[model samples]
Target chain A: MAKQFNQLAYTNLDDFVYGSCPNPVTTKSGMVIGGGMVYPEINFTLPGMDINDVTMPKAATIYSNIIEGVLKRAAELYAPGVLIEFETLPDFTEHPKYGIEVNRILLNGMKEASEKYGLKTAIRTTPNDLREFSRPPVMRSGKYWETMLELYEQCARDGSDFFSIESTGGKEIHDSALVKADIRLAIFALGILGCNDMEFLWKHLVDLSNANSCFAAGDSACGFANTAMVLAEKGFIPHVFAAVIRVAAVPRALVAFEQGAVGPSKDCAYEGPYLKAITGSPISMEGKTAAGAHLSPIGNIAAAVADTWSNESIQQVKLLSEMAPVVAMEQLIYDCRLMNAATLNGQQLMFRDLLVQSDSALDVQAYVLRPDVVMRISAELVKTQDNFLRTKLAAQLTVAELKKAIVEGKVKSDKRDMKWLDKMEKAIETIPDDPNEFYNEMKSVLDMDKFIPSEYGL
Target chain B: MATLNDVSQCVLDGDLDGIKVLVQALIDDGTDPIVIINDGLIAGMNIVAPLFKSGEMFVPEVMESADTMNEGMKLVKPLITDEDIPSKGKIIIGTVNGDLHDIGKNLLVMMMESRGYTVIDLGVDVKEEAFSAAVKEHKPNIVGMSSLLTTTMMKIESTIKQLVADGLRNQVKIIIGGAPVTQEFADDVGADGYSDDASTAVELCDRMMSDQSSSEALSA
Candidate 1:
């Protein structure tokens, strides 16, 4: 089944400059083979050789050592065909005197390491307005693009197999639109540079292309999932790309990656599915742990699909490889999506559904539909939400009624009717009869003031 | 006799052009620059600060208003001169080691500068020794360290530890901030203050300085 799926979905993998395998590789222990890339430690030092400052040399040396260590680790742990990515430190342009030199030294060191270790590298250039690294002649308008291209050329010259270009510096310049344009421009610019070692360059270019194209949508979560599905559909699922997919399915993978439990690239794709599953739901161990565990299954499926189709459609595999890094780099895209979904759903549950009870009977229907909100509201009402609601609704009700509700704990309801009262009575019987505790817990969940019209000018 | 209410309303409406015109008219009519700034501009900023904290405005809008306030300050700064520059207090601020991002730090600098404090900006990726040097050289009332990345935030602890080792920890209160930085982290590092945004940084500085003065007075 996996082989057949690969044959149908990935006919273009063979045309890639790199080889592809659609089927999963199984080891002697019967475990599937998967791979990922880890981001190196943040190098804070300015990169340069001629800077007279004592810190410059130390920074350069530290950066170089980090790259060397990463390369050595990658070689020791993975097979030669396995892909590893090293994200070059962003240039610090605020301190121009040493910033330019520091970036140069860092890039030069990275290039040397790539050559020696046969590693792939990606460079995120300083935003163009920043005083770091002189603007290249080709980039009179998009100066940052030219600077990044120069770094790509250097990487190419130094035997780097891949390059990922991202625009993340310059306060005025690094908007979402500009970032997308920059990535597209970098792709065309790199293509025009006439250095066509297709396998290496295409893989990196595909990653940026996926990231840029998806980010253009302006919804981080949707963009993340959309990018992963798009890349997978396109057969750009390299080992590192697969890692990104895994991260999309599991967000804790990010914490794990940061903690060095899993390689950075390994969990790249896990965040999306993990977030989608948990959106608007109680953060059950089922969602968090189950979503995390699901990565292994998807990873296996993706690997099987890749391995079986490796020989038949190298071109498609190559395309997949090219586009996969974007999945890895933008795991936060899924996180943003989950947050937006949660906020939207929570609003709907609270405002449009929860308050519209038909009778004195508590309408468990809405609560049933949104059990997470029910639990959240139940817990919050006992703590903070009731006070807020009480204060907000106090003006609408009779002062006598309001005081009785506060003191004697029996209040008439106009909105919920008699059915709600019966339901409340039944609910009270099943739980602690302490209305104050229940009201406080409910209060803890709802900030009724946020829903109310403000007293001041709009 | 214009109250803070009128000035605050003017700021909320983003009537910078009107503010400038009104301020210039006040100056022309012989109103003191310090009084106009304190009663009008600073009063206006105090309102804007809470708005910013509440997410009523984002970074760009805050920065734009800060820029407007800066222009107004430029007109007033020259009028005051060296002798007239009131000493609210001195602060040394920088992004901690291994973090180059400084948009928050820069905003805090501009906001602090507007509030009449002497600010020594140590710049990004600042080392512990450099911070120690600045503290020793300037003898500032407070030292502020910022880190935007979780990885770089670890440096703040070492920097504070270094300050303690150098015997300068007790001399200057420490304040920490940035995107990833938390008050819990600040407490862990023994920092005297933590602010999530630039306006809050100014408020914290004001409170910290006043507290220091009161403590000194009690000791004396």
Candidate 2:
């Protein structure tokens, strides 16, 4: 079982600043994520590698070239410390050996880069979650789960400095709710199903990481909130709804830290700020720099509270001057350099406030990410012991804040969009505080055919 | 007793239980089942389609409304035979090979179904052979593919190639969507249409079906 968070990680919001966490994780290569200054975590993808072409040799060559290009550029730019994340293609992990071999390749590149350039570096190996390989994917206890565990173990043993995954525990439910814009079901997915999966999965990963002496870096809500973020970006859903769902996702991601994963949460998890506020975990966040991977509304504001700023993920394709990953590294290094300079000059808080002020009022998505807002929402979040109630309180508080911001003319929003806020507030108000009661009510209401309760051990 | 307007309101409110009660009440009041469907259920969705496109109603509200309509339909659909009902068209859709992401595809499915199309959902990571097989089996008016990953989007071309290889290319119009998918990519891959969002995808399907019928009429 995971440890329950009964209180906020810190007392004073004003002093709850970025560039550090309660449990800072130092990697095998002496790369510290939350020790003091913010570092760049560069995530890169294979350049258009087809699923059929993901053999061991091809993965090795492709990853080597990509990392060499990124690190070589980092060396040229005189980057102090960098973190490279290898998020596996599903095929690489479907065959666990290939996944392990690829991890070894990535680690070797990081080692060589550190030795050759006299630079400090670490590698985060994130195995692709393949439980979704089954249609109406069995979320737990299947061949896919077994192989996923095997890959994690081997990768950790292979000297992966950090362990992370974009786990899809409740994605089957969350995806359905997201498309429907059903916040009630979305809460059920994130607060209940997702929390259960995180506890179960993270417990094992933490154990494995401990056994192998690696950092159990936190998981991402990539399957949940990121999906909503992208859908909102495409105008498939309202930004207000996506913004509220982002806050609702905090409890689920928080389960990772409760299960003993330390710091530097996954770069793709935008819920990192709330988790950082609640659990004091070092969080890797991506924003404007991640436009190479995906476009988002909270570009500048996302960098406000990050311990490790990342470029999300860039492909290894070539640009006019350099490879895309190399270009991404140069951009990220400069961003980190500026941020570190601010910290060195005793102006980190001023820089953080500037980042927060830049984008917070422009959009509701950006507004909720403001450090003050994160702390405010997270304070209410820790008031509840139930995950369902935590999710509801998160949504209710965010809606209330957005409404307040709109009324104050701080955050501009259309009048018609107010109906959604009202509707969500009304819906959240009707939810029971007890998780069991809420679960029962949801079971009676939601379309159970869309997901398997058995998979979540419901 | 509930009026047809009340039934429509139930859908608009996404009152699933209310819709069931209202639909049953209308049936008990001897309301014509077809009138209830066209005027009550679909009429509500018609309002939703525009509101959704206009961004007044979001995807969840729209889907809730659609699900309410489905719930209401369950009560009335049994009273009639297949020929008595109207379907917009048949659509075969799936996420392309090597891509398991289907929230977008599922939204398109729901939107298409709510608009009265018969949708055959092949689910995610669908291979080219499966797509061609679905087309051959269902003889759909349109084929839609979704790919959220840049890497897996390349599979859309291969899937289209398989359709052409199977000599099924001319039978149905092809459409593609997803974040990374674009109009140029669709044209490059020989897809007949592209839409960025689910509502637009529904509109694209309607336009393509209309165009196909018009072309067939001219040929005839």
Candidate 3:
């Protein structure tokens, strides 16, 4: 299980989760990659067709062509990963059968391009109304799940590396709690069937934080930050960080970097200034902030470079190479820190800006050792043996250590002293029995203390 | 003899087994199938729909109630011969060409069916000609179109334009909807109605049909 949790061993899983590569880039000159995470807009207009006589295949061809163009261009650019998110118009005729056909065509096209270029890809189906139990009828009817399982099984059989099922908006269905349960069920079912290839993907860490804002607000960004913290603490690697550096930084370095871009969008409302306040910086500048400032510049640089590739095709390749390592490291370090923090806190640790107060400028080599520094600091804090320090440190440790301590009574606290233990237990129950449960249990136990109570006093 | 109140009580209690027995009793007692449907099953749905909209009842409860209603409908539907099935209006619904998504479409069909609309679903990837052919054959009062893909959304307009060119545009009202179908898009396509969900589709279709029937009566 510990070996499986290692990122290096992730690709070996039968069903692996998919994530976008960091540092989307352009080639030196020629190509343009404009569409970011959103699905690229396509011209839906059919040429030379009388409305009454327009054929299904002809209409489908337009979409097929657009997808082909994008994938071909991505292959040429040599992108390590790309995400395809689904959204649709609410026409009654657009039933499951039609959706399947569309998905089939796109998947086929993606497969063809992936085979040709060895490009990694991720797919995100759109959010359906979980409150209504209304999914795209295909999905609601269970056929979609069956189809997905089959597709995954075949992919596993074919030695295709990564795939994932993601729900959007943290809505009822996409709720982390619900998704965790569903993933467990999927894994158990798949495992029982002897189809060991199954993986759950987590993307858009920033988005998840944003959606869980009310919970975060209640806990002073604790709930918002806790999901990532818990996942990391549990030794579960998040599939994608989705602007993690931006989530924790002062003034959110990503926003400033994006603001510097050609068409800069506003910083997400929930973050922006509030995050800046927490991080103790008025505005984050490039190379100034610890996290996003260092990484966002790379993404900006990659985007710029990718834009110049030969017709966006070669640009993707350049972007992937540049971004892959950064993304991998960002995810790895963030998860590791989260695990450490949660275990030490003896509760889910709230995400906070890791402010390293250095007396002087440090080289990249010095900064690379920050993880060890954090682990050391955490260990010292725990040994203080003060109740508060012990409590805090218990919440801060990695899941493995936290679980061991809890079981061994190394971190002693009475039932009353640890009110969060119950909540943590419930959260742990949500995960399936994947030997990963040990870590998840630790995460859940730690998170309870981070949750702000509804009232000032019990 | 089971009365509408009896059926309503059964629904309220979520007694699918009891509802089934009561419905059978209603049929044996010679109550008109349509009367039982309207007064018993539909009445119960009408009672629950508001609760669902108001958040008084969550999804699971509504689904269970709908399931019960569907069970009752199954029994009543067979008793009602083809001639007895009341048609609020005839509708030809399909996903636009190239877009093959149907969850939204299915929901709309279920809601519309519950409300007594006779719908001919052309399924996904329906071409313009097929839509026109269905319209011509069914002489539907309205055409409801759905699309899930932005890429395939434009097919709705093309289909409408084709209907107009074939001199069938004035004969029927077109309603368009889906995740991306905005009111402005519906207007641009010369569609009479646009709605976001299956529940809304039912309401919109009812209003459209009522207006058409009233205008026809006024002309007469």
DockQ of 2: 0.49
Candidate 3 per-residue lDDT, tens place, B35-111, comes to 88888887777776656555454333445566687788789888768878667889888888766555457556655
Give the per-residue lDDT digits (tens) of candidate 3, residues A1-458.
00110011112121111111122222112111222221121111223232222455754675476457666655554454443322222221224334444455656666776778775543322222111122212222244344433333333233221221222111211122211322222212112111111011121222232233200010011112223332222222121111121122111111222112111111111122221221211111112111221222121111110111111001111135343222322332333243234435532212111222231012111121122322332333323422222222322332233334345554433333132333333433454434334234434432333222121111
TM-score of 3: 0.43
* Candidate 2 clashes between residue pairs 3 or more apart in a chain or in different chains: A180-B59, A180-B60, A181-B60, A264-A282
What's model 1's lDDT at A277?
21
Q: Highest DockQ, which number?
A: 2
Q: For candidate 1, give the lDDT of residue B31.
A: 71
Off by over 4 Å in 3: A1-458, B9-14, B58-61
Expressed as tens digits, the lDDT of each residue in A1-458 for candidate 2 is: 55777777878766566677776778777777788778899988776546554344675787889888888889999888898888887876787877787778778888888889987888888988988778777877788898888998888888888889998887887887787677888888888888888888899899999899888898898888887888887667778888999999888888888888887899999989898888877899999999988898888889887988899888777899988888989998998888888888988888889988889888889999998898888888887777767877888899999989988898867665688788888888887877788888887767766677778778
Relative to the unseen true structure, what is the C-alpha lDDT of residue A386 in candidate 1, on a scale of 0 to 100?
24
Q: What is the alpha-carbon lDDT of model 3 when measured against the actual structure?
A: 0.41
Is candidate 2 or 3 superior in lDDT? 2
The order by descending lDDT is 2, 3, 1
The best candidate by lDDT is 2
